[model samples]
Target: MILAQILHSLFFIFVSYVLYLKYNNGVVKPSYIYSIVFCGLLLFVFNYFFKGLSNRLFLFLLMFSLSFVILQFMKKFVNVFGNNEELAKRKQLKVNVLSVQDFVFKKLFIGLICFYQLLLIWVPGIFEKMMENQ
Candidate 1:
């Protein structure tokens, strides 16, 4: 059970890493093929344990899409604030961006990342419990 949970966490880590790479480079690296395969294994495990396919698959699709969207937003925020030397000079972890709007967006993006991270942490366990319940 512990091993399964670890694998589940790895699934999220690998999937997010792959997405991060793909978003940055727009090309899939040969080395990450195995990671991709591991992710597929989890998906298959989900499919195998859960009897119904058509309806549940939509939920999975939405999960992946939401992840992609959050990643894109992260990239955009980084790009928007990434250029300034002033932001780089800051001592604290928090930065004071150019305007209130930028600050709000930055906080929002950070919140989204935190929320998504929690989702990644809990989702596999949720799937496992659901599978066991069936």
Candidate 2:
């Protein structure tokens, strides 16, 4: 179970890095959906060794495939609200400036994933507690 938790943390950390690279100010190649397929399969295979109808694995799966959704929703949020012009202007014609937003977003989202892996967030001990209550 501890190993599972470690694996979960590492996987999401990698994903957070990937997201940062995807959004960082640069010429990104048009992406392929294969990246998503690859990540999901990788996550499933590592966690498959544990046998359970419901457990932290189920929660992590929701985090990866559902709750997170790669945070693509941020595009709409950024569009409707607006870009961080203060951050944008700070770049000042230099190329390859590090995006503080992407960096923070990486930490924020990935930090939650790691935190939830450790604490289980809203679903903390949910199944185990239910089993005990019976």
Q: Looking at model 1, report the run of 10 residues with the lowest lDDT sum.
A: 50-59
Candidate 1 to native Cα RMSD, angstroms:
8.3
TM-score of 1: 0.40
lDDT, candidate 1, equals 0.54
Off by over 4 Å in 1: 46-62, 65-134
Residue-by-residue lDDT tens digits, candidate 1, 1-134? 34543544455566555555555455778768786676656655764675323225324533754665676677676775567566677734225444554544444444454446446445655645755798
lDDT (Cα atoms) of all candidates against the true structure: 0.54, 0.51
Clash tally, candidates in order: 0, 0
Q: In model 1, which residue pairs have backbone atoms overlapping below 3 Å?
A: none
| Tens digit per residue, CA lDDT, model 2, 1-134 | 56555655555555545555555543434443465556556657655655322345545445663445447565456552135566467664322343444455545765565455445423547646855797
